[model samples]
Target: MERNIYMNTITVSEFSEDQNLIFNRVKKTGIPVIIMDKGTRLAEIHPPSLPEKQSRKFGCMKDRLKIVGDIISPASDEKDWEVLKY
Candidate 1:
């Protein structure tokens, strides 16, 4: 059985002889290059994927947190530590 993939096809000899050219083409075009040997598929050279942009939202968890008890004064029967006396 034979397959005809008519994209960017290059033989092993061509790839070995002109690796830099093929690499540059793949990098610039972001298209994969198919490597073939004796008319059989061998390997593919694909361009590196671009990193995704991350979106950050400030106060996204606002009002999600609950205040259980007093924040300013210490808990009942809890004496102030000496380290806190500044």
Candidate 2:
């Protein structure tokens, strides 16, 4: 499913007073707000997701098996790892 996670840009000055408005919006709708300060990006505020996605697939069982298989597969012998020892 395509989830709607919106990000909006607002000047830092405008965000100083309307911070509550931004927090309320994120809390209510789970959207994000990017605050810009003097033309440079400042900060981002948003509701946290229920669970963070796994960043390293090797940490999982299926991924570990797939990675191990790839490493031991006959095709893996075509490449040499000694050259990468440095």
Candidate 3:
């Protein structure tokens, strides 16, 4: 996981102490601020910027057949399936 330390942070109790400063930082800095309790992470503060770009490897639904093509295939010299019935 990516660890971003430049983001602001505050204890759970500090958040209750000054709501304005926390709100302002989130608005102006546009960075996340974590709320902690007893050194354990409790909550995060940040606004999502934009959706992630779609991967080019998968392309679109039109490539369904191509995906199936990548699946591993059985050996061409394999014995007949009738042996499986026994």
Candidate 4:
């Protein structure tokens, strides 16, 4: 089932006059507010949603990744690595 949420709509003048009140209301209640200017929507103000906590799963990408070459050995000869000595 899909649920629809309604947002409170207000004019620019009202928001401009009572910025703190409107902002506090939005923060207290999770509902968002639509700011309209001359009957057209100009902006929206809402509180940020909390991020969901996620657990790390080991080996989740097993077999999905490819190893092109030998990982245990260096790609080039030992003499070529002397460039970093400085």
- Each prediction's RMSD over C-alphas, in Å, is 8.7, 12.7, 10.8, 11.2
lDDT: worst 10-residue window of model 1: 1-10
lDDT of 1: 0.77
Model 3: weakest 10-residue lDDT segment is 1-10
- Higher-lDDT candidate among 1 and 3? 1
Best by TM-score: 1
Candidate 3 clashing pairs, residues 3+ apart or interchain:
none
- Of candidate 2, the 10-residue stretch with the lowest lDDT total is 1-10
Superposition error at 72 for model 4 (Å): 26
Give Cα-based local distance difference scores for all models.
Answer: 0.77, 0.67, 0.69, 0.77
Better of 1 and 2 by TM-score: 1
- Model 3 per-residue lDDT at 51: 85
* Colliding pairs, model 4: none
Q: Tens digits of per-residue lDDT for model 1 on 11-42?
A: 88778877887888788888898999998999
Error of 2 at 29 (Å): 1.5
For model 2, residues 3-33, the per-residue Cα lDDT tens digits are 2123477776677766676788788987677
TM-score of each: 0.52, 0.47, 0.45, 0.51
lDDT of 4: 0.77
lDDT (0-100) at residue 12 of candidate 3? 71
Clashes of each: 0, 0, 0, 0
